[model samples]
Target: MEADPRWIETPDDGELADRLRQGGEAVRAELKKVIIGQDDVVEQVLTSLFAGGNSLIVGVPGLAKTLLIQTLSEVLDLSFNRIQFTPDLMPSDITGTDIIQEDPDTGQRKLVFMKGPLFANIVLADEINRTPPKTQSALLEAMEEKQVTIQGRTYGLSAPFFVLATQNPIELEGTYPLPEAQLDRFMFQINIDYLPEDEELEVIQRTTTVAGEPPQAILSAEAIAGFQHLVRKVPISESVARYAVQLARRTRPGRDDAPDYVRQYVGYGASVRAAQYLVLGGKARALLRGEVNVSFDDVRSLCAPVFRHRILTNFHAESERVTTDDLVKQLLDDVKPPKSGM
Candidate 1:
């Protein structure tokens, strides 16, 4: 990862923290114009954006996953591209390809590289699981290296590139599941569900009328980048860091730190990336709550998304209807709280 030049001279800690909170509030206000009551999903997206990480949104169809990303692009004033991943999709379709073209003046043939939709500032990978692993790997390089290499040449993506991939969980047939490697690249796997009764009613009322209002743009791409830099400056206590690590390590089966329930059910634990995301995501969560310091609550709340995809359950666990979410909750409950003096 390239060093952020904005960090050369750190701004006043207090003032910069306040700016991050204000920016987050502005983003939320803009998204509310179209999105109804998915505050948790919205928060996770905002947190990932500020933490400079990608998100995988899994939900049933028609839950506004695409709309949520579109609204985010408008709010942040970033170039948004949506790619509909299908079974027949190819890697070149997303990473672009070299095409032979005739020069207008000389009438000479030259290979021109046409950029794909992945070059945009914000990418909505719609139905990502519909595509095979080969096509999915195209995004892996971009997500991890923040660059694309084609034909023995590398093209750096725009600064602050974010991929918000959506996958349908209800369908299994004719779908290619994402590999663990690709899945681990995502900072958070957010589960978006249907709206509540009142929220659904509100959505009905709003969409029923033809006069549905469009959201106005709030922050520019540069401004969003600035806010992301600010998130990195949030201070995390030593205890929080250790807690984050322990939380990740304890998910493994038969570990000393693992709860009895976790040891019996979990087949594998989260990777170190989960611990890193826990700290960074907790900091972002704190910033969202208008705090300069990370708190245990931030880490606790982030456990579900951070561990859901990382943990693998055993067949016996699955037979018992045990979910990774349940294991994460149990781990959080089992971990002792920080000392009162600290």
Candidate 2:
């Protein structure tokens, strides 16, 4: 499918970009009615949605991780399903099972496939780490391929399918750490923190005093799919593209171009996917800001989300309290943009 040509530079470019910006802002406002704070978290989630990628939200329990996914489905007017991962959960539990039943017309018994909760448009894999590796692997096919094979038959999921998986950062007992392979499927592993003092107070007041209804549907599934398509129409300059690649490459250790801190503290660097997401995310951000083309600021703002999941730190770095966030910040500070009018 081709992107909308109207998004390119034209006489009505300013007005059209403004409309797209308002559309995004409207979605955020609708979400805020139910979600209290975490505007940054909401934006990142929205960006992933518009970028057509899955998100892995990591936060302590009671941070509204499930609620956030639920609210997003409501606002987007998409089908939402939640699967609570447990130790005894099996692969069939997530990907569906085959049941033997007699045919309606014939006396012969045949096996029929029963679809699982993963068939929905938006799936919330709540406490994903609680499940064993075998059970978790069931989602790998669905997440990456957007389809599940059951009983030798594959069923394709609905369009705009997104998996919002959540994990408890504090819990370790009875939890299976996600393998690196599955982790790579996630576009962004966002860390959701506790709400601010004032935001917590507001949340209590809003939910307690009034009859807090769910958020109103701001955009239909079709509209959301359309917006995702529109994001691709946003242009990205070559310079900004090169900057994204350079930032991702600098994460590697023992490279001639590697910064001193990266070689000292970094164990592993971001993969090529990091650079791809950086540009795609930059396009979405540019569209959000009423711009047809991406700028340096757009790429810079998205550095954290793009590289956070890709960079791996060592024991020494962890002991020094250095995090992926710190590495990303250093990259942004060290990388200089090309000067204009030079």
Best by TM-score: 1
Q: What lDDT score is found at residue 248 in candidate 1? A: 89
lDDT per model, in order? 0.86, 0.84
Runs of candidate 2 exceeding 4 Å displacement = 1-20
Q: Highest lDDT among the candidates is held by which one?
A: 1
lDDT of 1 by residue, 232-298 (tens): 8778889988989988888887677677887788788899999999999998899889877888889
Q: Which residue runs of candidate 1 sit more than 4 Å off their true CA positions? A: 1-13
Per-residue lDDT tens digits for candidate 2, residues 202-318, read 988887886666566666666566667777878777788888899999999868999999998889898888888888888878887677888888888888877887888888899
Total clashes for model 2: 0
- Alpha-carbon RMSD of each model: 3.7, 4.2
